[model samples]
Target: MTWKTLIVRVTDSCDGTCYGCLWRKNRISGFTLPVTTINDIVSKMKDFSFDESVILCPNPLYNPKISDIILSLKKVARKIYFFIPVNSLSKVRNKRIMESIDELVIVTTTPEDFKVNEENLKIILSQGFTNIALYVAIGSHTINMDNILSLVNMGKEYGLRIRVGEIPYSTALTLDIKSILAKKGYSVGFTYGMLYGYMASMAFIGNYPVTILAKPLTGECRKLFIDPYGRVSKCPLQTSYLRVDKVTSDILRSLIFSECSIGCRRFELIPKIEISLLTPDGKEIPSEVLSLLEVISHVNSLRAACSIMGFSPSTCVEKIRKVEKEVGIKLLISKKGGKEKGATVLTDEARRILEMYREIRDMVSESLYSEKGIMRFKLG
Candidate 1:
């Protein structure tokens, strides 16, 4: 799948002492990304299609070039999302920059923050900024239900989008909020798919939708994160895996199988495809063999493909030979060389088989989606 969203960390300098802030824990020496770096990242992103760009910073107002950052990203993305602390709304000096923002994500924590956020929302609305969302981060401790309901009512009054995100390793608070909202006849259902890494449930309040995001889930990465230093990763919360220098299709394809580390280790939700192909001798072709074959076709090196697939050379050869014997066809043609350099290519029969498998796989995937294009996820 093409990358649907690109998250760019424009800055890491933050004044707020929000509990368990990821920026504070993983911030680098370079506080903000320069305009030149932003342009470079945007150019690289054009190679792989992305619908929207999210401007990330613990507090975007702290960046000196915040205006330029937003303007630069506006040229590429169809929509630009800016994250700003709710209390810092008054700090926005450049009204023109706000025009470039397609959505304003106002981060709030407690009831007190929401109180301030309500006033802040009014201020922005007066300035003609209507595309706004209130992002509420809830912790594991017991919360005041009255205040939470008050926040909900306020959202309903203003017709604003509300997103309640579960802080890492917490579930009960969001579940309680979901239960409360569901009981009130609010339209609540699971979101089409994961956002960032969080699996969310949506609740509609009048015309606006309130999304409650559960803790981060693993597998099937759909988001690409670019840090302040122009390094790339599959998720914002993980370590940078590659740089943005001369990014090719190979680099992007490699991320498809890249594993990202999750902060919460308790639960995992990964969507996968199980394929069963029986040969004449009652043998089945392993999925890993197909993946290895595909990687070899792309990189043109057996050793490099083996390293990427985490397979020993001898083991990969044995698997390939087994599949070849089962299918009665030559799957791979290899020319031996150094440890990491060699010519490896797929045979005509192998390409046909891989193409057929991929077509069936994509067909099955599309079958799992609704007519509106939302994935109809099932659990067993």
Candidate 2:
């Protein structure tokens, strides 16, 4: 299945360093991904439709060729997000970078950072970007939630969505303020990995179900996370990643059993079918008949369905006739305006055939992944 979201690592350079770095620990060297690798990712993602946004991770503002990389995916991606950092004196020198970015997520180390970067945050929001988020990274120092409460409100006044990440706040304090803060626009992100047990997840961040959903542990292995060295990791938390050059079906299937999410079965499984029908006389029923039937099944109007698939009314009817002649059965029932402007439906025989084909197509995946596994997940 094609992924709706793609997170590509553009650079490892950051203007400011935070204390509570979960991903960037021990990573000091500044690095940029090769242009060829970037092009390869852009080329591969041409099939998927990214409605959420293409997340350029670590940092993209430091990259000199950020615009060139973004331009390559502009055709396929609807929006581009950058983890652009902001400090007290935050100012983006490149206007193009600021303008091109659809989402600007400023992750803060301490609660005080929210107020400290208020002016810089304004500069970022003024660039016509509506999706501004402030993430709190809990460090060694304990922060008074009172100040954070006010800062979060201030951000909300300017329409900024705030996120608090991985901080072990008092369960009592989070319980006391969870609903109060949520009403004013607050999202707490909790971590659930081998490092931190699930008990911790259910305690502090359990008040918000979104915290569990946001965690990378619920991965589908759909994202291709490429590091500066062209190493590919499905989950951002993974340390053992495959090289970009050696990517193949065998390699991808192997990841279905990765160490992360050893027992969790949250991977999404979507089935798609493309089948051809044959008559006893050896007459072939073309693919366009099923393609048109599939479209008409969802949409009520035959004319609208034809328009959506770039098929003219006459051509669609002609194809339907040809298929009917080969199959020796009427496959569609047409009607005048009903709930929709016009209507069409697959006949009883057509429904039986479609169900049989879909069941067989689903068996293909089961046969492939039933034996192979990524832990408890079947990956045969």
Q: How far off is residue 57 in model 1, in Å?
A: 3.3
Q: Quick one: best TM-score, which candidate?
A: 1
Off by over 4 Å in 1: 1-3, 23-30, 141-147, 167-187, 193-200, 204-208, 215-219, 245-249, 256-380
> What is the overall TM-score of model 2 with all chains considered together?
0.50
TM-score of each: 0.59, 0.50
* Model 1, C-alpha of 295: deviation from truth (Å): 44
lDDT of each: 0.61, 0.51
Q: Estimate, for each residue in 1-380, the C-alpha lDDT of model 1 and write its tens digit.
A: 33356677777666543444555424535477777877776665555555567776477776688788877777766667787766677775467877877767776666676666466678778887766766666554554556556666676577556777654222322233554454455544433334434555444555344666654344444566777666777766665567777576567546534654553422322333455466667778776676566556656767655543334589789989988887788998776767634588899988987777656644654443333222234222
Q: Which 10 successive residues of model 1 have the least lDDT summed?
A: 371-380
Output candidate 1 Cα RMSD.
17.7
